[model samples]
Target: MNDKMNLYYLKQLLNKKHVMLVYAIVKMSVYICFVLFVFFSLFSIDFRDMQLSQSLIFATEEINNSSSLLPGVSLGYKIYDTCSSTTMGVRVAMALINGNENSALNEQCTKPAQVLAIIGETQSSVSMTIAKTLAEMVKHFGWTWVGALRRDDDYGNSGMAAFTEAAEQLGICLEYSMSYFRTYSQEKVLRIIQQIKSSTSRVIVAFVTHLDFEILLDVFYEHNITGYQWVGTESWISDSTVARLDKHKILQGAIGLAIPNTTVTGLKEFILDINPLKSTGSTIFTEFWEALFKCKYTVQNDSEDTTVCTGKEKLSETDNEYTDMTLMPFFCNVYKGVYAVAHTLHDLLGCNFGTDVSVNSFRCYGEEVYFDKNGDPVAKYEIINLQTVEDHHEFVMVGIYDSSFPAHNRLSVKMASVPVSVCSESCPPGTRKAVQKGKPICCFDCIPCAEGEISNMTDSIKCEQCYQDFWSNPHRNECVKKEIEFLSYDETMGILLTAVSITGTFITIIIAIIFFRYKNTPIVKANNSELSFLLLFSLALCFLCSLTFIGRPSEWSCVLRHTVFGITFVLCISCVLGKTIVVLMAFRATLPGSNVMKWFGPPQQRLSVLAFTFIQVFICVLWLTTSPPFPFKNLNYYKEKIILECQLGSAVGFWAVLGYIGLLALLCFVLAFLARKLPDKFNEAKFITFSMLIFCAVWITFIPAYVSSPGKFTVAVEIFAILASSFGLLSCIFLPKFYIIIMKPEKNTKKQLMSKVPVK
Candidate 1:
């Protein structure tokens, strides 16, 4: 029973065999279409993504910041005494120099010097002298410790030895030691200047008694040697005469020294506090310290009002702001110096100090210096170009100087971060940055190859030179290659067709002789009229150079190549068409005047071919000169190279090329479809039609590709397209036909077809 049922199923399948085959073919075509769609879509998406990422990443990495951080705790202090009496000069002098020396030395040393605290001139010349000496010593030694002081000595060295001896008694070896001289005569001051100028050590310690600082200032300004840093002691301060000397320009770069109180705000408050009592007739400590340090007004208090002040005073006092001899606040540069060091240390060690404002003092357990023993900071110093807002005064401060500024209301500080190095040369060509600010030779970036150039080794340290026909810039970062140009269809394939025509004519002549010699034979007498016309037509079109390449031609020849190429292509197609028609008609000629035979009869068929060729020629000539065909004037950017190309006029022109090819493809497709029903003997039409379809497809797609290609390669692209078209025609259409007919004549006809005798 199973055998009978299987036989019945086989019979039914056999009946629908044609339908099954069609269904299978349709399904396979659908699968192919889907696969092509997905493949192209993915390719396009990836290409777009690659292009976008290139621009964004390149733009973002060029400029970056590297600023350091501020320290957490209040590291140091500045003290200023503003009393305009005997000590004012000393106070002002000390304010400029004291902590500044240590700051400068810290900059040069291989380590940062962090001075945590500072106490200043007891608002006096005597105190300023001591402060100045201490600052010089710190500078000389490159000490990094925080320093504090009791006061200065316009009270003279009367107090220095006592203070030192007292500190010594307490087992505190003075960290710093210094000296000074005091004089008053102009001759003495000039002699002192001369003496210092002549001395081997070249040191100036101004501690003159009763001599104004202006005389010394005038002498120094007149002498102005480059490297002198004039540091003064107590007696140098309280003199009123120096204030009259123009400090802005004369004492501009001079360095002074003084002890500064811990807090600027505190000192300001103290000034304010003293301001209220100035009119009260109340004796304050400010008044006492001023007189004592300035060498004026000895105290007679015994015990009266002793809570506010203690000490002897100077008898000389002046009211002139410029000439006041009162011991005033020594405005300390140490305020910024100390703070700067603390902040720098914190940054170097990556430490946070603390956040409280009132907490007056700070210390580090094992303060790590960001330097070696050379007193040079390990970190780089940023050279600042600072200008004062009030006076437009300008100066440079290396490293951090947020708080420790000299007098004249100028402090050197800015928000910009210190750069590690000012400016280094951009990396040499051929290498790219492996990482930013990284040392070269290690972590270096690679130079990419330029266009029209390629490197075999992708890891090449330097880009290789481009091959012949190519060149790149100095860095070899880009490349350009010599372009290939086809010029036009006439230049290349036209010559090729001419050669093919000569060869084909020779073959045709040989074949004709052979046919005549064997005239009695039926196969020989059977004329291949289609091949004859094709050979003749192709030969005429190919040899007619009158119209093709000759630049200056009569209107006839001008009209000639256009018609010739059109005729040649048409004849080429019609030859194949005629051959197919001939074969079909020969088999079906028994039926009278068949459509193939009638439509393609010798004279009518030739005329038809001529008509079609002329129509194409007319259309081509008209289109070639119109805006759609010849839009752009060829521009010559290079001296040697010239290009001839058809530019699309507009969107309409762009679509015109596409539309023309589409029509040709449709015609070839229709012919191939109709010819498919024909018997195998006439199947040559199928091959010819398929070849035309391939040619049309290549050019139709090529139009867009050529148009969109960059100018550098657009001409090359057109050349490639022409080459591909010619090569395809020669190989696919002509090569196979010649292979069988000329190379192997035995396969030209079947034995049965040849043996069948014609009935006369």
Candidate 2:
């Protein structure tokens, strides 16, 4: 039967192994799958093709050809060629040409043809007409768009009425358009469009100042104004303006344009090349003029009366283009247009998707380009959007003063504006405002701090520091005396009390020993042992209370030092109460049966000492957690260095602890009174009562001393109080008992001492 049972167990164990193996295999498979899923998820991102298109046409005429070429298409699917001048009619032509080219680039040059999006354009009413024309034509391509449409053609001398009529005729929405008749087509048109459509579109229409600004109707291939939409114009395309106007976003589709004293391929190098003393032509036009002059183009002086020959020297008489000039008089922006087209194309056509047509296949190289409300590319253009007609909202009005003179004529051209309030009060002395625009000044000049002042804060309104002979406080807001004056009696008394306590204790110990060695001395035997406990408690209080003198207000010393002192002081008082209880027990032990006498033994005495100490410790911990101290300062002042001080919270909390100690003191007194009737030989009640009275007197005197003392001298007064009370009791009581034990050898009997009656 045993064999059969063992066999059965063996069979069961073998089956269990297979089950365990199967379970392990299943868990491993699950873990492997989960890890694979996570790994794949992290490494793969849905990379859809991106397309960027910017159309800007302004002052230059080159934008006309850009309307048919690919911009970012060669790189991916971006269309960049847009007019950049501020001329109204010309901006229109640039916008149309850029929009058309962008669409073609997206549909033709880009592999896996994608519909073009984003057209840059000017905001002139005429430019809007072209935008409407181009929009209608490209709507079928299913692409997003952006542009700068004019609010009104005020510069066309066409009153607001005329500008609005023309805009309506072109089907341009004014709210989404940037307005202003005068603008740099390349600089403003594209940016305005980007700003307007930035919320939704990443495509743009550039330029609103072209003679053929309304040629946007030709995108239909039939020159028919069917569904085509025109974003804006190039300066060479817009008609002459007739009225007054201000900041506007006319170059909506412009992508990037020429910046004075800057270059496209090597911007950092170009910026470094600009010299303040040279003219604008010296920096950017260097290569263009060199090429032109090499081709024998003559250079003309400013007056046009004089000319320079193709050679490096000046010509006596000729009307030739100043090809040698480093900067193009009005062609620097146009020159950059060629490179812009090349860059945009490169970004769009770099990759070749399968030969399939779909919106998802549209690929743009970098991050999505910026656009205006109408979905035009945010190409380079001048300011086309203005918050107000009269406010100095133009770039020049808000830009900082770059006084790097003649080499850069565009002074007061703002590079950046203060993002937040610049000043809350008058500029600190030494710093002056160069120009003010709203609350923040456009320009500021830093001035050095005066002889006695200091500039501690960033962008300080004025230098501030203490006057001569005055020392700055932690806050640095004001100055105070270098040396503190100890003025009050309270301040002077604590030190005095500590000294007295130390001196008196030493003397008492000596005298007590001298008297106790002589047994014939009746005085030594008469006093009670309870006197010894009184001296011990008093000395403890004196020692602990003296610590307050060393405390100072600071991060390290401020609050903690004061709290420790308080706890120690309370524990000392509790010790005094325990002393009184011992005295009462001695008297009560005279009864035939009294456990109270046994309770007065050394163990109980130690426990009592521990209990008092624990209670004070507990209170200090509570206060530390509940209402911890903090630094104090004034709100109006900004200070670098801070002052620290421990200011106790809620005197009520402190008083509550004091009250408990007071109750203990009162109990001590009552017990002493009850035991006073006992014989003087063993009676300590009289001494206890006297010591309690002395303690009360010292504490009462402390209040007046504390109130009258200077802040720095308050600790001294406290120390004095501790000494007077504790030391006085030592002299009055414990000194007598020591005299019996140490001085009177014949009277010193251990059996007799132990037999003494304990107070109840």
Q: Over 4 Å off in model 1, which ranges?
A: 1-588, 592-599, 628-645, 650-665, 680-683, 696-709, 712-721, 747-760
TM per prediction:
0.32, 0.32
Candidate 2 local Cα displacement, residue 325, angstroms:
56
lDDT of 1 by residue, 115-167 (tens): 22233333232443243333333233222121122222434454455444443
Stretches off by above 4 angstroms in model 2 are 1-538, 555-564, 592-595, 628-645, 704-708, 738-760
In the range 376-474, model 2's lDDT, one tens digit per residue, is 433322222222235332222122222123423422223232112112233443343333443223234556554334555544656566544444554
User: So what's the TM-score on candidate 2?
Assistant: 0.32
Worst 10 residues of 1 by lDDT: 19-28
